[model samples]
Target chain A: MLKAFASYMTYEFIGLDQGSRIGDVLNFFIYDTIKIFLLLTVIIHAVSIIRSYFPPEKTRKILAHKREFIGNILAALLGVVTPFCSCSAVPLFIGFVEAGVPLGVTFSFLISSPMVNEVAVVLLWGLFGWKIAAIYMVTGLLVAVLAGFVIGKLKLEKWVEEYVYQIKTGQGQQVLTQTFRQRLQYARWNTADILKRIWLYVVLAIGLGGFIHGYVPQDFLVRYAGNGNPFAVPMAVALGVPLYSNAAGVIPIVYALMEKGLNTGTVLAFMMAVTALSLPEMIILRKVLKIPLLIVFAGIMTVTITAVGYLFNAIL
Target chain B: MEIKVLGPGCANCHTMEQLAKTAVAALGIEARVEKISDIQEIMKYTMSTPGLVVNGKLKHAGKPLPSIEKVKAMIKEEA
Candidate 1:
């Protein structure tokens, strides 16, 4: 449908030759921009409404006093519905510990919340196919669960800041109940707000994709980072870690790289590293977690994500 | 009464601040609504941004932000 509109705009409206490179690039850009923006708006609004049901306070209550494996899984899944900001890490950490939620379970929520975000899922589905998107989500959850579980077993609670355990959060405020109308209003506001923040990144990503589609040689990236290269996954993850960007911001670059023939697994790992293991999140987490614990968390994430990348490369 | 909305100035923090202000006005109450963006100040009150502090007490923190009516009620309780 969008392609037809793009063709009409280029050929019938502007009278450009259908076979021209510029026309093809223009058509691709227009179609992608419209489709992605539409997808983002509808999906983000729906997710926000669902999110209104799973506030951090409620999530903490659900995970509080839960067992190991079950808690990890629940926390990982809830991380998707829960609203997360790195800025809230300290409060969230302190709140969870004070509420008697297991440290590992809280870590699961923290890891998955940023990694398996709605924007990342929707963008992957829109740009790639459903299969790749599903794989990314499942793998992201696995990473969170396994990493959190391992950290739990290590008994790293002692490494947390002393004040976190010492502080008492006296029956923290109750979750705000919302009517359907209010939920709709909040969702609308949230969708508009998110779109405003990410619109530029979307345009830039599609524009870059269009450029790659028009001019970049198909074999350029394949020659360097294709399936045969053993180090490609780790290299991608290493490069992705220091660069701080949300999924939306990185999708354009991912699109460009994939079009240039980078393997799917390498690109996926890169996206995970960028969103999940960002330096800023680490700096924020450092305030609550001692140095040794912080290093272990980063180390475990790096190893787990790298393994996921390699697994995908081997299978797909 | 003194009211503080704590956050790092993210969108939700701004919304919470606006809701607090509107609630204060709707109740015809004399109160100052302040936004605390500094991380240290926010930590002292609560770890959550978009926290609501009324007269030195932490009233609400974190998501599922309250409606204007709820905010008003919280203020009423404090007052």
Candidate 2:
């Protein structure tokens, strides 16, 4: 449906030759912009409503006192639905520890919250197919779960900043109860807010994709980061660590890279590294995690994400 | 009356601070609204960012931030 509309607009309305490169690029750009924005709005609204049910307070209660592996899995899954912001990282970390939620479980939540977010999922689904999106989600969860469990087994709890454990988050925290109408309103506002923030990135991504599709040679990226290159995955991961961006913010670049013949695994790894292993996040987490633990966390994430990238490249 | 909005100065915290000020004005109450961005001070009250403390009582905390009307009601309750 979108393709037909885009075609109509590019060829009939704009009076461009149907076979022209510009016409094809314009069609792709229009179709993708409409489809992606629509998908983002609908998915974000739905996810927001679902999120309204799983606030951090409730999540902390759920993860508290759970066993190690089970807690890790649950925390990783809960990370998907819970609303997380870096600003709240300190309090959430302290609150979880104080609530008796295990350190590893909290790490699981922390890792997956930013990595496997709704924005990334929707963008992946919109740009690639559902299979790629599903794969990204599963791999992301596995990385979080395994990394957290490893951290747990290593007995790194002592490495956390002592102040995090010392701080007693006062009891009897007030829970805001909202009616169904309020939830809907909140969802609407959240959708609008997210869209407003990400629209520019989406346009830039699609525009880049369109430009690549129209003007850039198909084999341009293949020459450097193609499947034959063994170092592509690691190189991508290494490059992604220094760059900080949300999932949505990085999708356009990912889309362009993929269009230029970058393998699925390398691109996905790049996306994960960019979103999950950012230096700024490490600095923020420093308030709760000690230097050693932070370094270990970064090491584990890089290795896991790099491995996932290579695995996808080999198989897909 | 004193209202303190607790956060690390994130956007939501700012919004909550604005809402508190607007609520104070709407109710025509003589209330002082303050934003506490210091992590230590915020942690002392609640672990959640964008927390609202009305006259030293924790009123609300965390996301899906309350609307202006709800903020007003919370302040009125404290009053």
Fnat per model, in the order shown: 0.23, 0.35
lDDT of 2 by residue, A258-312 (tens): 8898998999999999999887778888988889999999998899899999999
* Model 1: per-residue Cα lDDT over A1-316, one tens digit each: 7889989998889888989999998888888889988998999999999998888778888999999989999999999998878878877787788889999999999999999988999888878878889999999999999999999999999999887787765744545567999789878877887787888988998898899889988988888888678999999999988887888899998998878888788899999998998788888788789999989998999899999999988888
Candidate 1 DockQ, CA atoms:
0.28
Misplaced by over 4 Å in model 2 are B11-15, B38-46, B55-60, B63-79
Which one is best on lDDT?
Answer: 2
Chain B alone vs. reference chain B, TM-score for every model: 0.96, 0.97
Residue A258 shift from truth in candidate 1, angstroms: 1.0
Listed in order, the DockQ scores are: 0.28, 0.45
- What is the Cα root-mean-square deviation between model 2 and the actual structure? 2.1
Q: lDDT of candidate 1 vs native?
A: 0.86
Which run of 10 residues does model 2 chain B get worst, by summed lDDT?
B39-48
* Native-referenced Cα lDDT, model 2: 0.89
- Per-residue lDDT over B1-79 for candidate 2, one digit per residue giving the tens place of the 0 to 100 score: 9899999877889999999999999999999999998776787766678899999888877765788998999999989
* RMSD each, Å: 3.6, 2.1
